[model samples]
Target: MEEKPFLGLRTVIYAAPDLSATKAWYAKALAIEPYFDEPFYVGFNVGGYELGLIPDASIVEGSTVSYWGVADIDKVIQRFLNLGASIHTDIQDVGDGIKTASIKDPFGNVVGLIENPHFSL
Candidate 1:
C-alpha cells in the first residue's frame, strides 16, 4: 500500500491589510507573542502549529476553516468576541461530544475553535 502523502497541518496564514493592528489583536486573542516578527510576516507558535500573518492589500474570509483545539470552546469564543471578533458560527456539537465554532477576526479571517473529547497528541 502507498503511504499517506500528507503530513499533519503545520500552519494557517491570514492576510492582514493592517499588519500592526491584526498582529496586536492576534496577540491578545491567542495570548501569545509572535516568535517571528517582520514587515513581511508575523508568525505565532500556536500549540506546536504556526499561525502566520502576512501583509496584503485585500482580505476576505474564505470558506475553508481550520479548527484549533480548545478545552473550553465557549470560553474561547467569548474571549474572541470580547477581543472585537464577530461570530461566524456559534458553538454546536457536530457529534460524539465534539463542539465546534468559527469567528471572524478583525482582519476578515475566519478562526475556528473545536472542543473534541477525542483529540490528543
Candidate 2:
C-alpha cells in the first residue's frame, strides 16, 4: 500500500448571485485574479487561501455563510452591490475599528463581511 500525502485546505465555496460579475469584482477588490474559473465555479488565489465562488441560483436561498475578517469590508460591500449582491446588514461601526456587514449574493446566499482593526495586509 502506498502512503498518501496531505496538504492544507485548498478552497472554500461560497454561494454567489451573479457568478461572472462576482468573480470580476473580487479580482478588482482583492487585486488577485482567479487562476481557475468557469461559469459554474469561480476560484481566486488569495495569498495562501482560496476564495471559491459557487453560483447557486437554483438552490441557494440567500446568504449561506458569513465570511468575516475580510481585508476591506467597505470596499467589498460596495463591489458586491455593484455586481448585484444584496445587503442583509449594513456596514456598522461596532467598536474597536471593526466594521461589519451582512450581505446576500445574487443567488440568495447570506455572507458576512467584516474589517478588523488589528489585522494589517
Candidate 3:
C-alpha cells in the first residue's frame, strides 16, 4: 500500500484590511479569541482547525469555499448572520445526511459550514 502525500484541512486564511475590526468580528462570531495574534496575522483555533487572518488592503470574496464542520447548520448560520455575515449560499441538503452553507464575512471572505453525519476524524 502506498501512503498518501496529502494530509487534511489545516488553515483558511482571509484578507483583513482592518485587522483590529475583523479580528473582533471573528472573535464574536466564533465565540473565542484567536490563539495566535499579531499585527501581521491572526489565527483562531476552530475545533482544532486554523482560521487565519492576514492584513491586506486588497480583499475580495472569491469563489473558493472552505467548509468547516458543524453539528447544527441552521443554528450556526443564524449565529453568523446575527454577527453581520450575509448569506453567500443558503443551506442545502447535499444528500447522505449532509448539509452545507456559506456566508460572506464582513471582511469579504466566503466562510463555509458543513453538517455531515458521515464524516469522522
Number of backbone-clashing residue pairs for each candidate, in the order shown: 0, 12, 0
Off by over 4 Å in 2: 1-10, 16-32, 38-41, 54-64
Every model's TM-score: 0.93, 0.60, 0.91
For each candidate in the order shown, give its overall lDDT on alpha carbons: 0.90, 0.73, 0.90
**Model 1 segments more than 4 A misplaced:** 57-63
Residue-level lDDT of model 2, residues 2-121, one tens digit each, is: 776857446556766678877776677567798888888888876666778877755544425545567778787887788777889888988999888888766555667778878654
- Model 3, 20-113: lDDT tens digits are 9999999999999999999999999988899999886454345368899999999999999898999999999999999999999987788889
Mark the regions of model 3 whose C-alpha exceeds 4 Å error after superposition. 57-63
Listed per candidate, the RMSD to the true structure in angstroms reads 1.7, 5.7, 1.9
Candidate 1 lDDT: 0.90
Q: Write the per-residue lDDT of candidate 1 for residues 22-116, one digit (tens) a residue.
A: 99999999999999999989999999999989896444345478889999998999999999999998889899999999999987888889999
How far residue 91's Cα lies from its native spot in candidate 3, in Å, is 0.7
